[model samples]
Target: MGVTGIGGFFFRARDPEALRAWYAEHLGVGSVPYGMWETQAGPCVFSPFPATSDYFAADRPWMLNLRVDDLDDLCARLEEAGIAATRDPEWDMPGVGRFARIHDPEGNPIELWQPEQPA
Candidate 1:
């Protein structure tokens, strides 16, 4: 029983309050006062990208990938709220999942994944 799951994710924010609000309002993350994000129990990817990986911005050290259930609905909601999200056919893995990319107000890349149905 050494480590359980991810307890928290701390990062530097230029305007912490504003960023927090943006995340809560748009992505429904960290909405609680304790900074505890309620997430579904599913696969959590912990791959560290190479320094030159083009998946996200070079200046950014990390990208946040969250597993979602209804990706198309979520993307539509974001777009209705005036947030731009990009979906590409190339990002879909036959047996893995479909992915969509979006950037927060501060330009942090966020990847939303909808996994394939279990056969």
Candidate 2:
């Protein structure tokens, strides 16, 4: 067979431990302390945006997009925790899905996606 799915996504963080904790606490990413996160099987987008694209901030090299379920609920929870999330009706695509934008403590852009469910 061809290559399997992605094993992990590693990125640089100013404070690795704190950033890891923040992700785990807010997004339920790690679940437990410094633990492995299990992700649901779903479509993953691999398209690369143009360098001059305004899809995300210009200063950052990469933006991390996480596929999630229940976009509204997630946004609410983040708001309760003092995290800001921006949602726009225009961002929704008929077959693609809904999208929201947020940032981590260090100002890294994070896009949360809720894929369209099959009818």
Candidate 3:
């Protein structure tokens, strides 16, 4: 019970430069070494995908979920920045949250979620 939360996430990017820039530009995540993001108060979903499950794209093993305050605004910003934000109503839960997916410049899927209530 000592672990409080996730400390960091690391993944491979085909073009690290462009991928990093994409996140930084649109999502405001600076390079990880000393990056700082203005995060909002919300529940961060922490779950592990089963080995045989095909929930996420077959190519990548993990998806990054970032908590946001305004899903609509974020989606619009991403779209305006030329980032395709895919909204799947099938993934919505009545009281859990809403989700939208987007791939980084390197094709790494990023899931953005806004919880039903602030955490």
Candidate 4:
């Protein structure tokens, strides 16, 4: 048997409605208030972190990594929306791809990743 990918990533937000709208406008995510994103992708990554893990660097135990096709384009869009985009060089990999960190209006850290293709 094989494990399936992520079903949904749930996190708290001060205002779910505004956050949903932000994602809809900036990232093109059809998000709903207090609801799972209805997407067509499958076999997503559902990872559990250790209590002492510093990977996410958040007060909370988990982080959401949304895969993207074009990191540069998305970052530009986020900037155009007046959302500050933060980049951590240490989080980037040469072949794996680039990662940009950003927090939502509610202060949820979201990692946007664009993975490299296999050679």
Candidate 5:
């Protein structure tokens, strides 16, 4: 049988506890060891970019893209919390979705995507 959906995402953190708390507070990403988050069913993109691609920072090996319901409201909340979320008009696709970029405390790139609604 082929693989199913993504079960988990593991990564190293300078301070695991603090980072865990940050994620929980800001993005509602649950922690491990019994803190599994139930995400809504949606399209999940699984693709790799070229090594020389400038879509994200060169120093970071991978960028995390998260599906969101309301990009504008989320970006506003993030800004109110003192986290700067940047958006570029060029990044938007008419039929694909809208996008906003933000960096976590430890400097990890996070892309927030709000997909176009089906008519």
Candidate 6:
């Protein structure tokens, strides 16, 4: 049988507890380590970028792209929390989605995407 969806995304955090708290408070992600997070059914993209790809930081090996329901509201909340969520109009596509970029406290790149609604 073919592989199912992504089961987990594990990464090393200098301060795992603090990072977990930050994600829980800001992004509503599960705070418990190794806990299951129920996600809505939607499209997920798994693409490997070139080693020299400038789309994300060169320092980091991987970037996390999360599907979001409301990009504007989430960006506003992030802004209020003093986290800079930068957006460029050029990143929006007719059928793909709108995107914004933000970094975690430890400098990991995260991309927030709001997919275009189906016609």
Best by TM-score: 6
Pairs of residues clashing in candidate 5: none
Residue pairs clashing, model 2: none
lDDT of 3 by residue, 5-102 (tens): 65666677676677776778788886654445555444667789887778779878888888777899999999998888999999877688888999
Instruction: State how far residue 103 of model 1 sits from its true place (Å).
Output: 0.5
Q: What is the TM-score of each candidate against the true structure?
A: 0.92, 0.93, 0.83, 0.79, 0.94, 0.95
Q: Over the stretch 57-95, how does candidate 6's per-residue lDDT look in tens digits?
A: 898999999999999999999999999999999999989
The residue-by-residue lDDT of candidate 1 on 1-119, one tens digit each, is 98767777788888888888888887788874445677777777779988989988899999998788899999999999999999999999998999999998889889999999989
List candidate 2 segments past 4 Å from native: 31-35
- Candidates 3 and 5: which is better by lDDT? 5
Query: Which pairs clash (backbone N, Cα, C closer than 3 Å) in model 6?
Result: none
**What's the lDDT of the predicted structure labeled candidate 5?**
0.91
Q: Over the stretch 52-75, how does candidate 4's per-residue lDDT look in tens digits?
A: 888777587677788888888889
Q: Deviation in angstroms for 64 in model 3?
A: 0.8
What value of lDDT does candidate 3 attain over all alpha carbons? Answer: 0.79
Q: Candidate 5 regions off by >4 Å?
A: 32-35
Model 1 stretches astray by more than 4 angstroms: none
Off by over 4 Å in 3: 31-33, 38-41
Q: Candidate 4, residue 94: CA error in Å?
A: 3.3
